[model samples]
Target: MSFQAYIDNIKAKTGKTPADFKKLAEKKGFIVKGELNPKTKATEVTNWLKEEFELGHGHAMAIYATFKGKTS
Candidate 1:
């Protein structure tokens, strides 16, 4: 599937946009001031998404990608 497809499916499942995730990540300290914290690992973020949001690995990674400034 395409990247946008992954993003769309994530939204359909979670009802949240990248901007929303960004805000939550900021609150959770995955990000700081719109920047992804260098000390944070992808697995840490992905695991949090998996546990808290019930997101599968791909979807969780997509959100983590967004934290790294990707569009999808």
Candidate 2:
């Protein structure tokens, strides 16, 4: 699937936008000031996404990409 398609599907499934994920990631300390936290591992975020959000690897990675400033 395309990147935006993945994003759209995630939103459809989770009822959250990228901005909402960013807020949650910030609360989780996975990101700070709109960037991925240096002390946080990608797996940490991906794992949380998997467990808490029931997202697949690719879908979780898509959310992580947004943390890294992906928009397209």
Candidate 3:
């Protein structure tokens, strides 16, 4: 699947855009001022996404990728 396809599926399943996830990530301290905190690990964010949002690994990683500045 294309990167956009993953993004679209995530939005359809969660009813949230990457922007929305970014905001939530900021609150969780995984992000700071639109940037991902260097101290944060991918697994931490992925696990949080999985537990809180019920996202599969790939979907969670997609969101984490957005946090890392993936826009395609």
What is the lDDT of every predicted structure here? 0.89, 0.93, 0.94
- Rank candidates by TM-score, best first: 3, 2, 1
- TM-score attained by model 3: 0.96
Q: How far does residue 41 in candidate 2 sit from its true spot (Å)?
A: 0.9
Local accuracy of candidate 2 as per-residue lDDT tens digits, 8-46: 999999999989999999999898877899899889999
Residues 1-59 of candidate 1: C-alpha lDDT, one tens digit per residue:
87788889889988998889889988989898789999899999999989988999998
Please say which candidate is ahead in TM-score: 1 or 3: 3
Which stretches in model 3 have alpha-carbon errors above 4 Å?
A: none
Model 1: lDDT of residue 30: 86
How good is model 1 by TM-score?
0.94
Alpha-carbon shift of residue 25 in model 3 (angstroms): 0.4
Please identify which of the two predictions, 1 or 2, would achieve the higher TM-score against the true structure: 2
Candidate 3: worst 10 consecutive residues by lDDT? 25-34
- lDDT for predicted candidate 3 compared with the true structure: 0.94
Which segments of candidate 1 are over 4 A away from where they belong?
Answer: none
1-72: candidate 3 lDDT, tens digit per residue: 888999999999999999999999999999997799999999999999999989999999999999998999
Candidate 3 Cα deviation (angstroms), residue 31:
0.4
